[model samples]
Target chain A: MSKLSKKQKWLVAGLLAVALCFGISPVTGAMHIMEGYLPMGFCILWYVISIPFVVWGFIQLKKSIDANRRNMAIIAMCGAFIFIISSLKIPSVTGSCSHMTGTGLGALLFGPAAVSVLSVIVLLFQAILLAHGGLTTLGANTFSMGIAGPFLSFGIYMLGKKFNFNKKVTVFVACFLGDLFTYCVTALQLALAYPSELGGYSASFVKFLGVFAPTQIPLAIIEGILSVIVIIALESYAKPEMRSLGFIEQEA
Target chain B: MVIHWLWVLPFVLLLIGGLIYKAYRHRGEHHHHHGFGHKHGEATIAVDTYAYHSGIAHWNPAFKVVLSIVLLLFCVISDSVEVSLIIICFTTFVTVVLGDLSFHHYFEMLTIPLVFLIVGSVIILINFSWTPMTNVILCLPVFNFFVIITHDSLYVTVHLWARAFGALSAMYMMSLSTMSNEIFSVLRKAHVPALLIELMNMIYRNIFIMADTQNRMRNAAESRLGYVDYRTSLKSFGSTISNLFIVSLKRSGHLFDAMEARCYDGELLFLETEKPLNAKLILMALGVVAYCVLVWVMTRGV
Candidate 1:
């Protein structure tokens, strides 16, 4: 196999970073930490702050749309689809239930940019109804789960594609890694914010690993397997739809 | 649970002050964009930014360190309702005064925990377990406060709404300002395990992708009139969810293929964007250490 280029190496690095963060501490729910726990001044500060990145993502989406109108719509539809599916929860241990975020699928399809746009929308809806995550945290949440996750997955996907690896294996690795990355970042964020409460980095990181690994690791593997299965199904049954969505071309 | 008057007083004062500060700041800052007039908007933002930007975003990291240390110390030293109340009141006050948040916001945030506190305290009082006088004194006032303030019932009928919004607001502030990417950089620099770091990155990326897919499916379902009822709609929803899982699986497969094509060898590398630690940041670290020491000294006897 050919060696990775500088860009690919950077991509891998970025992906690994995201996975470690999320895996260490999965951002489990739609809304993370609620309002009024931290000092209110801090909340207002972050709200004003995350605007630039959100705007930037939209601009990127616009450019992508202008470049490929049909593909853009399909991508947008997929994004919307993910938002809806993830909202539905399933029962889990600890009297709490878990739901699928579907971010891994987005990364596999239209790449990370599309996932960014979708994340903003999903978080918006969640804030309105369930109030799981607050409006203030929207930007940060978007940056963490939305922007970082898809980008990492896409980068991994591209690397796998270049290497001529088995298609199924490539997808499995990408999805698993992407799902894991979200949790790791959540842990790190928790460590930073509640260092004393969380018992500093070492303690918090260990606690996060201990708390999340049992649930999240298995969840990642399940998600990865599910993603691969879905892709296979799409290839077989919905080939036309997949092609329209730009998952595959007639030549491939 | 000996609630120290002094300990409780500081906690309440600080909390209220923090809230007021946030509320005041929100009123002055016209730059803030509350897209939907959500309650506790400013407070939420403040908490999110504090969480996200605590260490890296040119802010005083010592503030968070000190605050956490204080909270922990308080938790350890004082285990009484009086102390809890004092801490609650002080924290609420800080939230209101310094944070510039509304009283209603604080009330709403504390509503759930308040209920639990009241019920548990009352039960203890009724049972006459372990110093009935203490229980009666604490329970009556708190219950009375809730009754006078909100006029809610003490029965199971009262909703047990999770304190999700308040908790999320705090969590958000913590996450928004801090860059997760920078965090990984810090971890790697600290020589943390490479495997652990790799896992974190992968999981994070997949969350957004999963969310995106879920969103798309929801829109499609809505367009097709899939969410009107409970039973049929749930079935359809189940199918949709299953379909999403399948789609995710396939996508992951494709991504895996792509990675292999690029010659990925399971190892990840990257460049660092952070500059050398500045004097101010170092000082901030030192300040955190000093605060820790101070907290240790203050709580030594307790």
Candidate 2:
């Protein structure tokens, strides 16, 4: 075949641009693996991997509830808060609106274990109600958005505090990294399931990462900034609630 | 061969137009509030709202749950296009015809997952290579590499898309027809832990109240031009979320106090309404299962 003329080359280029735009369209706010998207084996493996964290979260929740009967109500409220946050559309310069993960704030407040439980419930709600995720893929979704993201986010917050970094900046970095890590784990999960014929899992991973990057990066940044603002607002307006949750020191 | 390749131009343009229409139709005006639909003036109440009013709402929750699970499992494991198509049709009949869900709403809900599936399938469809491959649909040359679409990738993408739609419809059948409270009751019957059930119940209940509060707060902010620009919207959203957190804390505390005043114990109990499965429904479910197995066997190795 002969090489294409300039106009034909530009036409091909325009077509490719359109195709890529459609492929990366962030029209849907959902980041979870859709129903039956993964192979059965991957589904079973993810469920097995996620069960322990969910059980541990339940145990922590049990402990807190046993210590105080009111904790059940408080925890439920937190879970509901996470659900509402995820449903809200956040403004981004990327022109693709998406929902907030809200795991960062939940992890910072009630610890990672409890946030895992909260997120599982939220994921279930999304699957059943919003059809954003799926029951079969619930394990994978929880592992990425709940278990992996919040644990790393909490770890960062603790590390930042131990080193005595600027408080607001620490919150921002922790929340931001946590949100980004959640998307990374999601991409990894997708790549594992759909490895390319050419470069196998790693190449597919890069492709998935590239696909998620344009929209998710902005969402992560928004999550970080929103977390900082929420914390500051909480400190000012909800001092008693913050102190009760042991998030703030009690004034003498 | 060149003419065959040129057909892709119109296809791409059509797809672009379809996507633009979809985007315009679902603009963020639907703001996920409690007690409403996303479409213009449609009466969609998430899942529960539909479930409560479904024509099949009185059908046994346990039966619907079990049948939906069986269909979902069959759809995924069978990996047959015929089976997926059958399940999709069956689910549409059940959810839209029998359950009396709005056809428009059902299609809208299906589009939510369809967008994600399309995006994922497209990623799987396109392949990158250093050398040319057989059955190439479109190939674009880059620096020392080629972007290609192969026949094998297209086949895999179509297979996945079919299976996902099948499984998704099954889930919708369950969720769209049965209320969350009913599902919790069924879970309780299946011996799920009481604590987790209670937590789910509370969270489900609180979700509506909080969503309403958030909706009101957002509307109030919008009235004050809180979302005029990106920076202003961020500030408004931040304050709204923080205020929502504080409000939730207060609501939970008051709820606990109210429960205690009403002689509440640590465990929360809900009254379960009994809805038994009829023989006709059982027979129909069995027929559906048999149909799936038959399809799987017939379409094996396709």
Candidate 3:
């Protein structure tokens, strides 16, 4: 077998990290697409949709490990990072609080494919151990927060970097937008399952968006700031580690 | 308008806060057994601790999973709330009897999802509209609106809630009785690809180590008054988190070294515990299937 390239390795590591995050303790995110929230058919459909992505993630992971065993620790670290950082709850607003997904940072650092898998692991553990997310709706949750959020974050980050935006500003915007869009995707998912009589899917989506806005807007801002600060802190304090993880090039 | 939107917040938050408080107290009370991870999450202990028992714990993981999943499916697929509610009662009885867990503790754990079901049901109950419809549950002054709960909506809400409760009960039965690793073995048995399983095991092992590291770091920061105010808290949180990431990367490096020293193959290996099948096991399996049938029969037409 041929050795995988650096980009391939990251892709592999991210997929493996999904399985890794699945192993984390179940101190989960609050009120995730909880169990039984979606109907039976919806749940099954979601599992079907998500399982392919999850399997692809693991396949990528196996290839990575077979190519190089040392990548195991890197995979573990990314998984741990997803678990702990996303678990951190900053006060979202007044009455309610939402957790920073840590997806923005993970996506920017790891790529969306890896983050997609990692998010599933995080959501799975959240559903199982913490009882925050639902086991049945894992697919829908994975699609929304896992696949969608990271893709947006990665997309935005790439675009910003390509446009020669300041690294710090790019990180902030990516994280902020990533956080906002996670809720947006979540709203869409929820609406899809339970469309309102008032306006059907679009209206229900808007309603969920409205409901999430008060909390998620503050959360987006908090998450954005947090990601930027973390990036800066790592760049300043752990330059070598960042370089090791390929999160940064050779230190300035 | 504001009152209707915001009313559920206090209620939900209070329930959540109470859960946290209870977990905190329970952790302090039982810290000797759990060590540091209890503070971060008590549900880990509360729900999973019973799985170690030898009662139904000795049963086949695949069979147990099938049984639970079937029950869960019934709960969801069934049209009758009566059937779902009956399922809730049945699973509750089995879980308590077979698992030998406290009824109070079991019910307490169940309440969190019950609360979620209530909050989610609210969305089903109300839609923003000017016209008042039949079966209005509450005519609130919010958005010049009333909660229009017709018979059909009521039936759906109650049915969904019951299904949720029933499915949860079924889940509790499986989770409470089977060790997590056993569940992993079931995944393995189901031929869920070796790479994913190994990776999951690796990550699962690492969760404890990360928790230990994070717990120590958090304590150190707390001692330094890192969370004294909101602003300081954010700054401190940012630094601590980044520090943890750096530390995690380093830890993984060390872990890789250790694995290499152990002649680490990528494969994770664990011996599955074996228990001889007996009539009791058969009876339990039969009883569960029978119980399921009985449930459908009793509440089918309702």
Q: Whole-model lDDT for model 3 versus the true structure? A: 0.68
- TM-score to true structure, per model: 0.44, 0.90, 0.82
**DockQ sort, best first:** 2, 3, 1
Model 1 per-residue lDDT tens digits across residues B124-183:
112111212321222222211211111221211121121222233323222333344455
True contacts kept of each: 0.06, 0.71, 0.44
Q: Mind giving the per-residue lDDT tens digits that candidate 2 earns over A161-229?
A: 899999999999999999999999999999999888778999999988988887788778889999999
| Top DockQ hit | 2
Question: B1-302 in candidate 3: lDDT tens per residue?
Answer: 33332322433454445455555545645333323132333345455666776357877777777777777777777644655655565566556655555556667667656666666666666566666554455433233444345555566677777777777787777877777787788888889777666656666666666767776877798899987777877888888788888887888888888877877777666788885556776686576556556655654543
Q: If both were scored by TM-score, which would come out higher, candidate 1 or candidate 3?
A: 3
Superior candidate under lDDT, 2 versus 3: 2
TM-score top scorer: 2
Cα RMSD of all models vs. native, in order, equals 18.7, 7.0, 13.2
Give the Cα error of residue A130 in candidate 2, in Å: 0.5
User: Rank by lDDT, descending?
Assistant: 2, 3, 1
Candidate 2 interface RMSD after superposing interface residues: 2.6
Q: After superposition, how far is residue B122 of candidate 1 from its true place, in Å?
A: 23
All DockQ scores: 0.05, 0.58, 0.22
Clashes of each: 175, 1, 2
Error of 1 at A147 (Å): 1.9
**Which regions in candidate 2 have their CA more than 4 angstroms from the true location?**
A1-28, A250-252, B1-44, B135-138, B142-144
